[model samples]
Target: MVRGRDVILEALENLNEDEFKRFKHRLGTQPLRKGFSSIPRGTLHSLDRLDLTDKIVCYYLEDYGMELTAEVLRAIGMLEEAVRLQQAAGQV
Candidate 1:
């Protein structure tokens, strides 16, 4: 069976660039409540459209301090890029 990471990667690979760009933009502008038990319905719906699993979505929300584009890199296993983004965000 595929691991969750692989499944997430596969889903991400299929995301069209334009859609992902719009989603990232929306995520950046939205304010998330702490702990991520729930989020704005619109954000949740957008995540669903991106085919992000609940775990991945939760990870993004919990680490919402970083930009969504950066989280996308991290989620897709681009550690170096994610680190760069973290540094850019002053999280590192």
Candidate 2:
């Protein structure tokens, strides 16, 4: 079976540099719901896109990683990537 990290990596890989930067910005800055924290700027600072995706998956686990990733994608106007992620994960 395809891992959630694989799905997330694919989505991130599809983004151009600017979009990927925006996505990381959102992850570092967005206000998450209660009990959930945004990724720290320091944490985000050191990682490239692939590492960031891995961090998200490991930190949030598969399910929440999928949701949070899609949410961030949509927040940055990447609806197609969000949908594709959900579909790939069989959540659509």
Candidate 3:
């Protein structure tokens, strides 16, 4: 199975330069700054899109830390999105 990091990386590869910049800017909350160093820029954008508040990111990063790696973070995020999608579909 493809790892989460791979999924995130794949997503990054697909974005145009402007899109990528927008992604980065979305993550500008000060609280998330600590994690900004651990993850790659592309993954940062993904987190931003997910709208993980600075507090949430800090909480998760504090507990799990940067060890999540690129693949794992992507995988987890994708899984969360999938679950949300499934739930939304069920509501229809």
Q: Identify the leading candidate in terms of TM-score.
A: 2
Structural similarity to truth (TM-score) of each candidate = 0.32, 0.89, 0.35
Q: Show how many residue pairs clash in every candidate, following the order shown.
A: 0, 0, 4
Ranking by lDDT: 2, 1, 3
CA lDDT, every prediction? 0.49, 0.86, 0.39
Estimate candidate 2's alpha-carbon lDDT, on a 0 to 1 scale.
0.86
On the 0 to 100 scale, the lDDT of residue 18 in model 3 is 67
Error of 3 at 4 (Å): 0.3
Residue-level lDDT of model 2, residues 1-92, one tens digit each, is 78888889899899999999898888887766666776778888778878988899777877788888999999999999999999998942
Q: What is candidate 3's lDDT per residue for 1-92, written digit by digit as tens?
A: 43333333344444456654643543333234344544444546666433433423454442232222222333434444334333333333
Shift in Å, residue 75, candidate 2: 0.5
